[model samples]
Target: MTRMRIEGLLAAFPKLIGTGKQHTYVETENVRYVYQPMEALYLLLITNKQSNILEDLDTLRILSKLVPEYSYYFEESICKCAFDLILISLGHKENVTVAQVKQYCEMESHEEKLHRQMREDKIREAKDEMKRKANEIDKNKAIHVIYRL
Candidate 1:
């Protein structure tokens, strides 16, 4: 089931690619990194599953927070994309706990709660964005059809 989810994400990635969407891949000469926090997020999502998500997430949070310093060497969009993926993946699961996330990210309870709330807001924003785009497409199609009349 986990692999299935990963596969689904990969399959949908291309469609989600381009136009400010970046992540999943990065390279630095002999070094490379794939922003895949699947295991980390999985731990957070599966309440029953036991793993050191809090510790791992703390490391990630620290790493992520420091990324801005390497702006010249890294792409912020890609970094953000990966973090977004991690958060969204966890948000999809109902087993997530604020404590787990906070502990992992080494954040305060308020910060953790805020992060969770932000995820919900992002979901809503994404829906609104899609709806607006769809309406625009339909409106354009309508105009094209009317032109032939």
Candidate 2:
């Protein structure tokens, strides 16, 4: 869906939704807003009307659980840690630990290490070539001076 349409739905959402706790979803003409109301915030999943409601709700459930895990206070501060949350979510296969997340961020991949090593080797080789050329020039200059004598 377009950004304008999503924005229109979000703008209309407050008025469209009821104050009661009974409703979990609000449907529009072309879209479905499957949402879970958390304290002071809403965990919302917007999908096309043709999409499966059960799957959307399941995704919202997973997000609801994950959000609270990453952001405890459920305030604007959560936005600041959003990248870290995404990293933690994508970086782990099984249950994730803080140490594992830290390790994942800190550790270099094999390809990256290989590239760094190759770059260092090239720099060393360049320096060695410069030194060798300088030595050759000095020897030529010495031979020229002896020849002049």
Which numbered prediction scores highest in TM-score against the true structure?
2
lDDT string for model 2 (95-145, tens) is 544556556657899999999999999999999999999999999999999
Clashes of each: 2, 0
lDDT of each: 0.50, 0.74
User: Against the correct fold, how does model 1 do in TM-score?
Assistant: 0.29
- How far residue 120's Cα lies from its native spot in candidate 2, in Å, is 17
Q: What is candidate 2's CA lDDT for residue 42?
A: 77
Model 1 C-alpha lDDT per residue in residues 4-32, reported as the tens digit of each score: 95565545444433444345433333322
For model 2, the stretches where C-alpha displacement exceeds 4 angstroms are: 79-149
Provide the RMSD of all predictions against the true structure, rounded to 1 decimal.
Answer: 18.9, 9.2
